[model samples]
Target chain A: MRTLILLTTLLIGACSAGPQPIRYGEDACNYCKMTIVDQQHSAEAVTLKGKVYKFDAIECLVHYVSPLDETTFSHLLVANYDNPGVLIDAKTSSYLISPNLPSPMGAFLNAFDDANRSSAVQREMSGELHNWQSLKRTITTRNQIPN
Target chain B: MSRGLSLILFFFLVSISTSVGNKLHVGQDKPYATIHSALAAATAGDQIIVHSGVYRECPVHINKSITLTGYGMPVLDAEGEKEGFIIEADSVTLEGFEIRNTGFSYIEDRAGIRVKRKHISSFRTTDYITLFFGIYLEHAKSGIVRNNALHGKPLGEANSGNSIHLWYCADIDIEGNLIRGHRDGIYFEFATECRIRQNISEGNLRYGLHFMFSNDDIYTGNTFRDNGAGVAVMFSRRIHMLNNLFHLNWGQAAYGLLLKEIYDAEIRENIFQKNTIGIFTEGSNRINYVDNDFLNNGWAVKVAGGCEKNKFHWK
Candidate 1:
């Protein structure tokens, strides 16, 4: 009976060790306190142990993750701008910083599926294009309180 | 004696003329075809009366101290595209207008009526509410937004905007407004000494009323129902929340009132009924919860860790 219980616990834990769908409209952003409603701009991060933190916007995801240790997070994902609610891998996701596209937090940031997709909007809106690394750095530096 | 009598009558008439403001009428076949023309021709202490007509005039910028009154509850339609009015003047009176179709924008926080002045930038850091508001007031003082109905089709999943939003404003009276279908029914950030009374805020996506980083504010006799969260008071101190009704706000994150990091506040005589959580507190201190009725709630008061010096008393 003991071995059977241990086996069941392990099975349940393993099965739960994956990304969960963010409960939109119902779930509050763990960082900014807004409800995760805009599927087009929502973001989420999964820890290695399967704990998930959802955010209302992509910048909120970045703002939340910036102060934390990176090794704890296993998956970083953002909602695809074109697809709307479809979470894409954040490491390779393309970003657009444009005055025309105002994010929920007024950051003027949007995430796309690829570089080409971000570039397409940049062509007309005249914005700077960025990737995961550059966008994180830009947001971090820009939001840093000046002395 | 006749000259003296004429001079006394002339002085009396001058006092009456000074007390009453000039009234400018706006409607079809009137002196001004659009509200913009009337506003331009109007002076300080003048009243603009708009007749009952659908005016598709968004972005109505009011830069002078004047009374913009609607005679028969005129409709100022944004046509689901632009903002309705941006009032930048002090001591402005906006009354009896039905503002409609404040459109959506991820970039801009559009609204039905927006009053603002240049605000200190650090105030933005203390804000808990999100963008895109219905009636937005920023850095404004001594203004009155009363007896207005704002109808919006707000998005449910995320923040569409607050029905009435105040930022860095002081001594403003937001009263008797029916606000529906927005992210937050009413939101305040860095606002002080404001009086919010007798407002019906329902069908909102997020909190019916939310304020943060604001101090010495008062909210009374308001009804908040069918919201994601009834009211969220965060990072604020010295507030008076009295005689408010919060009901039927059902959700995982919903609460009749959610208090976080608040201090030195008095919540009195409020009825919290049929809510998922009557009151949830975290990191809050020095609060007096008195004479409040908590009825049929899932958790009457869910006290998280780090709360201190809290008193709860009820009949």
Candidate 2:
């Protein structure tokens, strides 16, 4: 009975340390100097020592972290526009950015974390989430979009 | 006896001369032979007929002047691993070939063909310089590329390669070619006094034809359609565009043609239709847009705040 109680206590500690919603940004984006809105197009980065720093845009995040080794970032999270609550990996995530997508920076899609979320949002927005291989075949190319 | 000896000598000489000129045969099943070797062994203007097979190699450096023709559509594989065909000599012709599968990287600027020289009149001083491009012509005076097809699958902004790229080339003729799936279908960076005619570019991610910092060039009778962004002319001067069709460049902010920081150009008798935006101009000065058609586009032209000293005449 005592061991069962101890195991339950450890599980609670692990659950408590799950990603805290930390807010970060300058007074404005370093690139465009627009007022930083934490809920929209913000950045989240976890360091090697378990510290998270936030920024308003990926551009700002890149500028801020320049000269610092990129390998220091452990976990990076950006907002998922489709399902508001979820955050996904930045490097692997697909983007549905176009001139028509509607953002402060003209019309373009920003950071997305989840593939399922990206797919859901792409379907909602009538767009397509192209994989790296297939995306190569479609855009930035000199051949026909294969049928 | 002397007559027979003379006849035998004559036949031997004829056979030897024929074998000397015909070193490489087109449409033959051979492992691989260097395009350079075939050109060197060939006579001054002999035709080096390359067959219809995937010649899985590149940096196919051309240093001598010759004619290299491929049977059907030969595939020249850069393997997406090295820069495609590089031309260093003069008076060479490449035709009836399909070049594809480019290697992607953030560091290297890979292209299907790189022309390394700026196109200028023979008597002109060398004060003005243009950036080199695909089908590159560096110090090369005269060349021609016709009836060839080029396709590249570029991924992301970094991986995307340019098709039919040219630079520092002069008096060149590019006719009846189909190019698609690249950063720019046909890019002329610093080429001057050149002519690009009768080509079709479609479904590219960036400009169908991108010319930046170039001068004194004539582009006519070409079709640019369904590109990610239609066309861009930046920091260039003295251009003449006529009898071209720009259509179906539909995206949120895509334009049929984008003129930025250009000067003293003539854009006449061209058609722009079914694009999200017809012409987007910024800081483009002292230009003439005469007798051009802009139909069914979202916005005919948008002068985004930074324009000065430009003229647009409708006839």
Candidate 3:
């Protein structure tokens, strides 16, 4: 009984779900078929079954998840534009579409986990700010490649 | 009359000087201390010879029509900070140099050697390492990128670049290049009328030769081995694939040659050996698969839906 309990606990611990680090040069983006090299603008999505999908840019994450059911994914994370390689929650994050900041897949989108910090950057860079749904609508409406 | 005579004399002297092709030498012991100084002093139709040394510089922009040749294989190291050379002018011939370490950038697509304008050019580079893109050709036409060897050791989870990247270019020749350990060995997007021949592209992290939206291209006599995925030609038209070898590309979703949304391609006399899928086609139309050998692949030809009028000539 003790061995069974220990084995179940170990299996559950082994299968624990979280965001894996985006290997910049190694991992390929699941959406746009690019190598996920950008640290500041990449993103990740975790399904309810614990399957992780990585993207090279924030817009790719939005475009990929836009048509899917909302209940499919348990967590959606975007890279903090201020902090390179740091993944933050996508639902609560604020987005800034600044032409001054270019991304890997050419969406001109930047994400910040903090709203106040995103607004401050917007003040400095002088672009539009958006929430999750607005950003998704804007990204899906327009084409992906701008150049 | 005297003023006209003097002006004619000046023009005669300038023409004679330029036609003679002055040679500027750059070395530690030569007249010029740096290649930049030599380039600044050089005019059009001049030849600048760079001697053997490791020179750390970013963006050695060549704006004049000149021949920049290296003696004894000089090294231009960017130190993972910036690009190596940005060739702007036409009729530029760059030969015999080792360019390495064009550092990674998130905002910009940096390269070891970037051919910007890309008309009537010749680039013969030796080796490159740890770069985002090895040789990038943008808006270029009628150029030859030949006999270059690029070896990349990519950083952890950082975005890796392609070895030879061509964007919106046309009528270029990519020949005899040995590329390994990149995202894609040769990548072409919106490029047209190009020829990729006699190149060995192996062990890349993505497709060995990945081209999209290119038309009227010819790829022949190349060896693509052990790449993450093999060659992928998507959204292209009137391409010719002849006498190439695709071997040992194995993964769950990998293929020897993947064709998606392609139209009117002639694929002839190629060999695909030991891959997960030999030829995976989707939405391809009017393609002729003639004399292609599939040896020991998981699936010889896995046809997805929406393919039309593909003639398979079995030899």
Give per-residue CA lDDT, model 2, range B62-111, as digits (tens).
55555567776676777756765665545555555656555654334555
Candidate DockQ values, in order, are: 0.30, 0.02, 0.27
TM-score for the first chain of model 2? 0.51
Clashes of each: 4, 33, 8
Best DockQ among the predictions, by candidate number: 1
CAPRI rating of model 3: acceptable
Which 10-residue window in model 1 chain B sums to the lowest lDDT?
A: B120-129
Prediction RMSDs, each to the true structure: 6.7, 16.4, 5.2
Scored against the true structure, residue A117 in model 1 reaches a CA lDDT of 74
Q: Where does candidate 3 stray beyond 4 Å?
A: A1-42, A48-60, A81-84, A92-131, A141-147, B1-20, B105-109, B118-132, B157-159, B213-215, B235-239, B260-264, B283-286, B305-309
**Model 3 over residues B60-95: C-alpha lDDT tens digits?**
999998899989989998888889889999988888
Docking class of 1: acceptable
Tens-digit lDDT track for model 2 on A1-147? 999999999877664443446322113333332223334455566766566665545434544555467677777665565544356665576666543343322223454665676666666666656542343333333221111
State the lDDT at B148 in candidate 2: 58
Docking class of 2: incorrect
TM-score of chain B taken alone, every candidate: 0.87, 0.78, 0.92
- Candidate 2 docks with a DockQ of 0.02
What's the alpha carbon RMSD for model 3?
5.2
lDDT of each: 0.79, 0.61, 0.85
| C-alpha DockQ for predicted model 1 | 0.30
Off by over 4 Å in 2: A1-147, B1-23, B26-40, B115-140
